[model samples]
Target: MSTPPRLTFVNRQGERHARKLSLFGLRALIEEMQCQGVTARAVLSGTGVLSKDFDDDASLITRDQRLAIYRNAQRLAKRSDVALLAGARQRISDFGIYGYALASSRTLGDALDLSFRHLRQAGPVLQITSRVEDGVIKLRSHDPESLGDLLPFVAEFWRSSNLTFLSRVLERPFPSLRMLLPYPAPPHWRAYGRTFNCPIEFEAEAMEWHFAESIWQLPLPNANPAAAKVCQRFCEQVLSEQPQGSELTDSIRAALVNRPGRFARIDDIAAHLGMSLRTLNRRLASEGLSYQSIIDDVRKTLAVEYLERTTLSVEHICERVGFSDPSNFRKAFKKWTGRSPSDFRDADLR
Candidate 1:
């Protein structure tokens, strides 16, 4: 049997994020359900996805088709919380596939580096860029279009998510967070601002963050060579089934990291990845994603982990997660979990 393209997903707030179908896996999932007499197509269609394209190559499916699958899956799953979970369960099998690699890293920063390296291989529509601006290292996003009118919502979530994780990883509160947005203001600002206690910048071009540069070089407290080897082995095993093509995500992740350095342009990322800008776009299209989507997903996962595990102030967490403002993080967090970060932390702690 021919191998299918890999599957990926982007976690969107309010609406289901996005999904990229793997022709082989999708077909298998559908076929298995069909044999069992389950109307897989009907179920998927109920989720707003058409199941016909399961046979298409990952590179062959249209954006609308992939989006439909995501929408349908979210609808079928009912709770937005379960969309990523269900999607991961079907396409990824073991959540440990990517988490395993992270567990193996020498530090949170290293783990983040590896995440960017293989983001598309997992799924998600957020890009993470960790760089040093002035003397501070900032973790931020490169795309604005993806956030849409919900840019504030997305940016706030990014803030909450990244900072929450950083506190857990560093065991200390960051000095401050700086958010970058293109708009003026929103009504729910106070909820986010009070929670974070950090200055919120507005009308900026991109979602940027600032942290002490020292953290970038800090070794991951959990960096274990044995663990990393184990995780790497697991990733290789699962990813082995994937066709051996020049990995585009690796180059894209690198560009995101090296930003404010040598690679600050998407064209530069494309050039470094050894494909034309158009080809890069086309290849990402095949996966049913844009480079920026994966970046945001990485940021969200990390941000949430921070929020849950650490006791650092919310504003500090916001900066770490790439939000220039604390209020934005609050709105985004509420959208993601239907609960504010403070409420989440308080409930979980209690």
Candidate 2:
């Protein structure tokens, strides 16, 4: 199988702050909350999202705002299976044109490849990856440590919703081999067995779903090459038009990179951007970011680029990225991407 293309956005931070996500996922969460007797207003409170936004197909939300809605769902929903139920309720139509592109693909593998390449268009909350190993296809989700207490809920929604989409595309039940989750089993763990119809391993090191290689070759029921091409073109057009990041954030990142080892303080960055410290803080807070977060994001982006595009040694890369201690850099890199520098490079080379 071919690897999906890397995102055009420079880094994770750019992608998250980009205002390109549709309200489909948030709408699903709101509907699920409504089913549980929670009002839409209650679920959207403090999210800076409005109910009328759902009616507009072109309305977009930032990933930060989407997370805010998820946080609210976690707080207001009565049942532990809110994510699962919400995800299960999703149909292909809920995805709009993105769904049509996948459905029109000639084979399941083609659809999976397209989905990964255009994943951001769907407004995903997690970084998903796929690989074929030992005659089995492994689909995994990378947890953003920022999710914090909402990890379990988000993980469940991602897993369940994906299974639902795959099943619908194939016009049959998904033959999942097993599931491995990082978090402990929920109180409604039995629902997982009923939903996936497979073994569930909780408290594992990662979130992954396993399937036999044959599934990849299965022909999609609604394959239409002409339609697939048109829908895919539309997806590409939308992705190309997204704003990479806010002007202020981009300026902050450039300032951080230009300084190299001597990282600028918040006050320095504020002055460089022609704003007071208070204004800088407030602006970043408005975008769900902080000075420290931007610094961390720039460091991670530079480190990953070096690892993937250069032959620099770990120690040398660490020094170049402003880390004085190689050991400390290793820990921070793993925390940022869930992989050591060497391991990340090896995977990239593969």
Candidate 3:
């Protein structure tokens, strides 16, 4: 495989600005606080997270309060335990904010482009970026810190974010995807298995999702074509709310991949990622995949692309894709593309 591009994270103009004073995993934060000895009952009572109108499930703590909670947690714990809360959900959603803004889009790609443009709002702790190489778009994270203990939480968050966005916006099952992580296996593998309906990898440098680039033009749910204007307006507003950026996801992806050797067991990956095996498993389950599946899917996607685009022989391709036996590669290829390697290549050449 070609050396992956060093996806450098750069800043973008703050297109739209608004406030995102707190959102996402508020309940979890509250629950975590209980363990920390700050047991206020609701967002309004114990913390400034909730207002009288904050009873709705959709409401979250304000961005300032969110940061405050993290700061408070750090103070209480006498360490920097609340780093995750440094960024706002509005910014994180900036990655997908365009989708919500669009009344309806033509393809997932169009929506994703918006996501790519705005992912910085989530914070600089983790940044998600993608590059289209050899007909496959590889999405990797940029994180400076190792998220070993937080792998499960991070994995589940990605899975949940992907599922909720795709299901709501596209109104269809996401075509099979590939996930890669550097952490090892977790206990709740089966749960992840069902959600993504694809492979997961622990201890991987990047988590890649493979789909036809053409899918970018697919139409969104709402039939109205005029929605673009509204979507664009909201995009600006979302950016305005959160002027800062994040790269935590990016760091996490990098930490997972830049490991010492080839794929390690989930336990090993988790340890490397600084997360417990169970947490990794449980988080992946929430996303409907496991660490192993992510690795398999990435290999699977690359294998086909290599076969289609290169003159390499079957054995060469197999080796490049980490397959030990030609026969096993053939079997797996058949399952993936429904044709023998020779036939598949010939068809492509034709």
Candidate 4:
């Protein structure tokens, strides 16, 4: 028998910009919170997300924004099973074209491989890796130490939602052999057993899911090579269009963000990055970006974040984004988003 490929998916937290995610997962969480009598406004607090944003199919949120919501859910949820219940509600339709690509694959193995390659399109919060050994497949989640206290909730949500997706893809309950989690069992731990239908072990050395290798070759009922090819192509295009960060750009943005209210000169950034100003310019040009462009992008992102997530005045925001003149900041903000800062904030409130 041919050996299955080893797959590792990493969504590290060090990227310059957070990964953009569809509102599907957020919508599911919001629905679950609503069931617990938690208002959507309460759930979306400090995330710069609005109820109206959910109505737009093309709306996307940054990873940080989503994390803000997750934190809110953790604090406001009245039930311990909120993450599990929210995750369980995920339908294949929630994944959009990514789901279609998985559903049309020839085999479960093909879908796994495709999903691993394009996981960014799926908006995972944790760094996950998988491997096949002997007669079993092991999937592991590498928890980011930065997640600290929020690890359990995020881990539960990720696992449950993924299992739900797998069940729909296989047209049967995904028979996980064993599940190991790094945290202590929650009060509603029984829901884990009911959802996974597998032996659960908490407070383990690592987070892992074990599966029998035979299931890898299971033929998908909706296998359509032509459709899969088209969907995969579209997924690839969407992934490519996503904003990706280079190491230098990430460092530069980190520096810029750390020192708000002052925009670093190109020479300063170049020196900080351990390169000459000319070299920095050349490298940025190679990546189709300019130093001023990055500054503008960063300013625009921060400006919008403040406008939506805070009640800061326009002048205060202008200073925070390194603009000395409020009028220039207003013009730049309008140019970037086609709305003045006040107008944008007011619209978000509605």
lDDT of each: 0.50, 0.78, 0.51, 0.79
Please give the lDDT score for candidate 2.
Answer: 0.78
Please write out the lDDT profile of model 4 over residues 1-350, one tens digit for every residue.
33344434545444415546767656678889999999999999888999998776456677787778899999999998899999988888778888889999999989988987777677776556667878988887653333657777887887888899888988989879999888888889888889899999999977889999888788999899999999999888877777767757755765666555688899998887788999999999999999898888878877876676566789988988899999999999999989998888889889
Predicted candidate 1 versus true structure: per-residue lDDT over 1-350, tens digit per residue: 11111111122221223343233324323443344454676546634445554433332333334434444433444332332122222322222345556645776557656655554444333545455556665655654443344445445533554344344444454356555556676655554455445667777766666655555455655567887887777655555554333456544553543332122456766776667999988988997888667556545644555565455678876776567878997887787678888888788678
The CA lDDT at 318 in model 2 is 93
Indicate the worst ten consecutive residues by lDDT in candidate 3.
83-92
* TM-score (C-alpha, index-matched) for candidate 4: 0.67
Q: Which pairs in model 4 have colliding backbones?
A: none
Give one digit per residue, the lDDT tens place, for model 3 in 1-350. 22223343432211112243324434444444555566534323444554332344223234334434444554454223322222112122333335455325555665566555544433322334556766666666533122324445455544545554565567676665577765666655655556666787766755555554555667777545567557666766766665343333332333333431244677876775578989878877776776666566545645665565456689987876667899998998898779989998889789
TM-score of each: 0.44, 0.68, 0.48, 0.67
**In order, what is each prediction's RMSD in angstroms?**
16.8, 13.5, 20.2, 10.0
Order of models, best lDDT first: 4, 2, 3, 1
- Give the poorly placed runs of model 2, Cα more than 4 Å off: 1-11, 244-350
Best by TM-score: 2
Q: Which stretches of candidate 4 lie over 4 Å from their true place?
A: 1-4, 55-58, 245-350
Clashing pairs in 2: none
**Lowest lDDT 10-residue stretch of candidate 4:** 7-16
